[model samples]
Target: MGSPPWAADPAPASRLPATNLLTIEYPGYIRDTSDSLDRALVSLSPVAGPRVDAASSAYALAHLTSLLERGGRVVECRLPSGSGVPDAMDLYKHPILGDVTPSDHVVVRVHRQVWKRMVNGQEERRKHYRIEVLGASSTCIRFRRMADYAFRPEMPAHASEHPTMKLHKILEEMDVAAMHAHRFMPEQEDYYDGQGAQRRSNLAMIPPPFFNRQELPFYYGYRQNPTSSLQTVTFASTSKRSRRTARKGDADLLDAGNDHAEVTRYLNRARWRNMAPVAVKFTEDGPVPTEPDAMLAQMALSERQLAYLERLKKHLSERPVWSRLSLLNQFSVADARALVQTKELFALVAYTFADGPWRDALVRFGYDPRQDMASRFFQRIHLRGKAPRAPTTRGAFKAEYGQASASGKAAPAVGDAQARPATHLFDGQHSTFSTSTFQLCDITAPVLLPLIHAEGPSDLRSAPDITTGWYSMSAWEAIRSSVSKSFHALLSEAGPHKTSEEAIESSEGSGAGDSSEEDE
Candidate 1:
């Protein structure tokens, strides 16, 4: 009934200032699915946003077909079973390639219907043709096709053509150009009362900021600061002119502007000022629930592995860290361990809003349901943090890690220690990467809803301090989808306070309810 808080104010008549563009590149691949004859080669690229990739692939195939037809070759086109778009592998087919010995030639099976002179002057006989389109580099496409009706063979001497060289070059260009035009969810904004004080706060949102590893020294703050971990990036979309220029098989016709839409950061923001408060499990005042065994089961860990994880749990549970900072609890332990085991990390995250017309918006944008676009925003979260700035010089590595040799005695610092993975695995004594891994969990709020992690069975033997946070299914229903009062009280208590030096000193000295002091 009303405008959502996240909606941006309409742009004025004047244009906004120019912003730098970010070119996000993704790898491409080819899949063969000739198992059912329904599909042969499916051109795939992980670059397009949501459904755009599939559509672009189909258009590319159509263009390839047109280029072949223009060469004055006998070409028979086969439509897919339904209203589905053209497939890359099914563009053309023939019957003769089945008999031809595999050789170094661009073999094509095409069809032509010719009128018969002996049988009947008006009757037409379909003939199968095999043409090998050769390229300058000896590369060839074994093109094949079947005629509408079986009749006789035409151009039986394995005809050869050379247009494939141009086709190959054209296809390469299309793949490269594919990177230039793409789309993604735009940034979102919302208003919030600053920590229970009766005023709104400004916040920006991005989904799935990390796809490989987390970068340490990166800050997770409301505004970009020296400590902020997330950086700004741009997602370019096809310009209106480019859309008009998109013609089948012609890469050069694509619009050059690649219209710049909204700019977004690499992370989502929680607007409440009191977000850092450490929560208790199953308590009315905290985020977790009363029963959490089911949640823990999802991690699928053995007792021994769970026991090892306890060290991390204990470290995170310490006073100031729990209250003032965010860390991975139980729900994320299995995922965390997996990251370490694989030496790679990726967590898929989706953008969520308190309440909005998200489904309708996704539909309007032509996103497929499976694209997870209806989730509003989708991102692959990478958890590994970049190694801290390489210690400035060679000695710095020794200074950072302390121990230089395997023997009991000290060894001379020679090469760069930072280059070693072992250097990043631990702190002076403890596992700093493990600790930082927990920190990453907090930064990326996996649970988008309001509910927090609840308590679990006492028999469980993993981390004593590490408890996972999840949405309280029962509590959520009991409240009739309303937020718990304890949350509101938290905001009231955590509201922004006086920032004058005198007030700040007094608050710091008191240390009664100050979560920030936990860091110190």
Candidate 2:
């Protein structure tokens, strides 16, 4: 058979500008067919052409030049098979054998193979041809693997020897030092996102001495209004190097008078310095004070803390009982350290209920629950197994609770009662408490129980056992007596009046008994 058409001499290089030429390396093999060769040439055609103007062609050339400089690699080109020539092509349309001419600079090689295939249960002989275009060695780039010194050993050793033991020991000592240093380090301020999730701050990376040093403000003038006396201050960068670097571009534009623009206003200091620093004290024992007397005497309140205390007192005066989460949400204090400060201030005017109807809540010192049986705050209902299904309407709640009583099921324990409430118990006044507060308790603990108040059967009071339904009057009396004793003990520990006579006089002079009656 005669030599294939590609075996002929290559055509002269196109007269296009040398700068506009792009060299594409086809590293993969292509089937030596008329259609396959033509598709390859079509896919590799220069993106810029006669239809593209000189300006657009310049941009395309710059883009390709950048890609080549940045170590761009060859990507396999995918072309459609068994398709006719495009309508825009005026050249020979009928499968032109070797009519698709490439630049003479391109080098091509051909390979042939003989194979056997089964056709109609008979062995058939087949001849296969593949073509590969070899790019010039000068244009082809190869990347070498970078050496990693971290994994290499300074000294060679046998397989039986432990070469990494020294490195391991050093790393272990470093880890221990890091952990030990944490105990001595003061607590870092925490940041909070809009959703109230705690996030770590990077401010600790700054040196302590940097905060103590005062910085001078930088001023710059604009050329557009040179007579204007106002000088713009740079709030972001205080260093001379940064100021010089920032003004370099502005200086060029101003001297050239190319794009001189007027400055409207300087940066606002309040926006950048909005964060308030909270003082945190650390001791060898811990952050929390062990002795109440020391905490009351040494811990002086700041103006901000005193204002917060007054706001808290006003909230307590309006309502005798408030959940911890509700108070936090009201004040918008989400930080853990800030919450600790709030708890310390709260202890001065109120005390937490460890258990009972007011669990996880703070009751004002003078407010008593026994006299408020008619109030919804003092009411509670018991249910069996994980909290009842949330009822959407008042009728649904009545139906669910009423049916449970009719079925004669055993009452659920206090642990079960603490399960997430189906409906808002506080009339949706404190939305955050309804979801976050109750979930913190152990729902499976048999020893500790929760106090939940729900609108249920009117005859719930007749249930003989407190665990079966509502709490009895005797149970309330017992809770009142226990709470009174604990409150008094807390006062005696923190109050300045130490002697029995002084304590009696302090109580009588303050009219503690009269205040309780008035709060009721």
Expressed as tens digits, the lDDT of each residue in 306-411 for candidate 2 is 7776777887787766665455445431232355554567665555444444444666655544335433332222211122233543453232222233334575
Model 1, span 316-373: residue lDDT tens: 3341122111222222334333434521111101111111211111011122222232
CA-only RMSD, every prediction = 32.7, 32.6
Regions of model 1 farther than 4 Å from truth = 1-144, 147-304, 312-520
TM-score result, candidate 1: 0.17
Estimate candidate 2's alpha-carbon lDDT, on a 0 to 1 scale: 0.38
Error of 1 at 449 (Å): 34
What C-alpha lDDT, on a 0 to 100 scale, does residue 383 get in candidate 2? 18
| Global Cα lDDT for candidate 1 | 0.29
- How far out, in Å, is residue 295 in model 2? 5.9
Worst 10 residues of 2 by lDDT: 90-99
